[model samples]
Target chain A: MKENKCCCSKKQKKLKVVNIGLQTFAESLRAQGVTVAQVNWRPPRKLDSEMKNILDDLL
Target chain B: MPVKKVTVQQNRYADSVTLMGILDAVKKSGKVMLAEVQMGTPQNVEVMRKLGFDIPATVNANDLVIALEAQTNELLDEAYKDVIDRLDRKHTDGEETFNSIDEVDPADGWNLCQISLPGEYAAEEAKKAINKGLDVFIFSDNVSIDEELQLKRLGDEKDVLVMGPDCGVGMLDGVALATMSLVREGPVGIVGASGSGAQEVACIVEKAGSGISALIGTGGRDLYPQIGGLSMIKGIKRLCEDDQTKVIVLVSKLADRAVMDKVLTFADGVKKPVVAIFLGADESLFASHKVHGTFSLEGAALKALELCGISCKDFEISDEKIKGIVDSYMKKFSPQQKYLRGVYCGGTFAEESLIYLKEHNPDSQLYFNMATKYARKLDSHLKSQCHTLVDLGSEEFTIDAPHPVFDPELRLKRFRQEAQDPETAVILLDFITAPGVHEDPISPFAKACAEAIKARGGALAVIASICGSVNDPQDIVKCGKELVDAGVILTGSNHQSTLLASAFMKALDNRK
Candidate 1:
């Protein structure tokens, strides 16, 4: 993280974002001029696991 | 002289990517000078070929067409394969892979985490993110009071902000965090407990030539004694301390007495002026609380703007203007055309219309779906009464298909149904333009409304408001003009549209 002072004496923080759900939320962050990486989250399920494996194999 | 035109079509459907490649290939190949590679069905190819004859006898059109057609066929085959191969090699899951917030920081580099996981997993995810020392904006609903309390406390320990588990709208430093309008950067900072309420305030403030410093949406239940107005309190403090914020505005429907008391005490301590909207609460509630209280969302926005030395008078609808339109529409409406039907694309739009209409004309009863959040007490929402409003975005309407905002087909069908009804003298609608929304949303409904009007002997009044700015990609001006050209009375704002709608209904109701 690059060195940036806190806006207040509250906390030191960076501006990068991890959007861990809805694509809509991530899109908003990007629109707002934030560096956001959206996590493609799905429930931990057998079907998702199988789908993930298939997706992994596709690579 | 030679005429040139390149028309290409895949034996199968060529996706946009493949079509673009074919154009690029033709562009890179200097042989086809001034060539335009078009991707279309075989029908378009036949049309192109027929149009090729019009290139004038002075030019060798036949030779150019023959060469271009051959080149196009070759490019189509190669381009199609390249697209298919590229897509085959790409794994979407692999591209989006990240199991935990911990893996995100050093790799992807994000200091803030917006959590929208299910309520059950929300607290855990928030804790993990907070421990990683990131500000959290939670958009998850159904989170328990205990879980929310725990998550927020953890965020405090980490010395960062925790917005909400049900918060849907927030804008920090010109970035609309979740559900919000494209508000500009300015001095009025907002902290609201209602998503739609905050959105209305932000949008109205933006439209009034002023702008927002920030808009923080605390979750709907943040003011409950159990949750204890945690985020709202934090939001106020943050806005008060921020150098950019010249004024602070607070909006909420339900404020527990104890929480409101505590919040008022807190607001009194802040130096910046505060505008508070407690929907059902009296203005006297803030008399001793060091705040200005307004009842409605529109009033809240106007009040906030006023504190910062701006006046917003557009929400007020003049009776003369209302009377002229009412009388004009009243003349065309037949005896059978009596009822008013509103089909809204958004939940907030529907509620605002209903609230405005009810406040203006107390006798105008409205029926809404049971799925709406407006009635927390819950009506059998199964059926609608005479003057009904349906939020097309409600779960009941969006169960199988996409929300009508993206796909207006469902809303169009409903509009047609209402328009065809003999009693539907007025058909009210809302058009929202945002990124990812259907570009030409109004034209379909415009055609639908026109047809319905024709069926009704050209008597139905279509009143609508477009909820968008020109900055949005939907080309709202052109789209709104389309609605107007189709004989829709398009209002400048949702509040104006509601007044017009209610005025028409009241005038019609009085006649009966």
Candidate 2:
């Protein structure tokens, strides 16, 4: 809890964000004049262990 | 027809939109055993697993995009194909993809990140954002206490603020975040572990003609011994040090005993004036220090305002006023109608309404289809007791459907069910407005109530309270008008609505 560790963005600078999983929250951030990049996020497919291990190594 | 399962990549649509789509697909594409569709977010996959889909615990964001359990593999495959085709068309309309947070760093000085994924995956995602150096505000509910602790501990280690997993509402620097109301910006900053409490104080501050400097949500569990009130502590420090915020307000409707004292001790350590509202219970612990603790939401707002050198009248519902409304509605109840049925979208308001009702009749028979610490739970959420409350946003209701607060469609059928009951004298509702929820929740709700009353010979008293600021997309004032137009009695706040209902019930008893 340091004095300098504050996020009152009004006293600081513009608050940019990368929004994931929820779209509306990101949109709300945008409406408030913040820069936001929304990622169309989805979990990885439920690959079987064999496929998962292969994909894990391949990636 | 054999049950077949399919998994696909999640769509970019809002969770409600995608859920509604899957349900619609199920209804239309008949002979379906099961049709649950959601992004591979850890939370959603878990839900799909509960619906008997074979989704595992280790599912990742990029893994099985969507999973479906249907009658036949052939039929479900077709359904999955059709949905993916439609969603792909919807999402790929010239959209760029970011593999991870590291790839698409927002150049606008990415200060904070808001994660609304399911709690199962929320912490992992939050850690990723924190590692990349960003403060986190999580709107996702049901995150485990251990996971929340881990996230906050990591946040502390990284000098990041982790807001909520089931965080209710929030506003920072005058911008409305997930599940929050807008207040005029001024000198005071707020840190709330409860959404409804924070919104109430903020709205009162606005009405008192004072304004807020910042409004923060420290996720509900932040005050627990395990979490150690980390987010609220951080929020207090940030607000106190910030040059813009002169007064700091802390709100939590419920918190553990050990944790409560810890918060008070911390607040006392701060120099700025603080108004602490641990509502439904009173504490005189902070009367001497720059901290002031109160019981009611209005008192908290007034105290905060008073600290800012402003005086405001309490918007309490007087006995005479409650009696007046009760007297007016007394004549409308039929001889057989003797119960008050409450259907709410917010858990806090549902409990608040129940608290007021119990105060009116301590022996009253109240039941609810919710996870409440104070009241008895109904045998079935579908069944109603004498005085019943239903939190329609419960995990059970939203497992494969949209939230009633966000989509009124799920609650539409309950109106018919309750209205048809001969004993249902009153039907109470909480209409909410914010991002992600439907635009006109009250209008359709009003229509349903009107239809039910009309069908049941107009014996029922439909009462409602709309929670949100006028700045919301579904304006409360406008929705209140719609409710009034539909012959529904609209109260000002959730607490006021409860008092009105309680008084009306008392009047009914007196008529005997």
Question: Which candidate's DockQ is highest?
Answer: 2
Second chain TM-score, each model: 0.74, 0.79
RMSD per model, one decimal: 12.1, 6.0
- Runs of candidate 2 with Cα error greater than 4 angstroms are A1-13, A39-59, B1-61, B64-98, B104-108, B207-210, B284-290, B371-373, B452-459, B510-512
Location of the lowest summed lDDT over 10 successive residues in candidate 2 chain B: B8-17
TM-score of each: 0.73, 0.79
All models: lDDT? 0.68, 0.73
Candidate 1, B280-359: lDDT as tens digits? 57556877887887766667778887888887676556778888999988999877777788888877667777766766
Instruction: Look at candidate 2 and tell me the lDDT of residue B402.
Output: 82
Q: Find the candidate with the highest TM-score and give its number.
A: 2
lDDT of 2 by residue, B1-512 (tens): 56656555432334554566656865587746667665566777777777767775555555444566566678777777776676554345453435566675534366677887766667888888887668888888778888889888888888787888887677765677776776667777889988877877777677557778888898778888888888988888878877777788898866787787788789999989888877665445555445787755666777777778776655556778777767666677778888888888877777777766766667667787865654678989888987898888877888878878767887877877887889888889887777646777877777787788778666778888776777777776787788888888876677678878877667665555
Residue B395 shift from truth in candidate 2, angstroms? 3.2
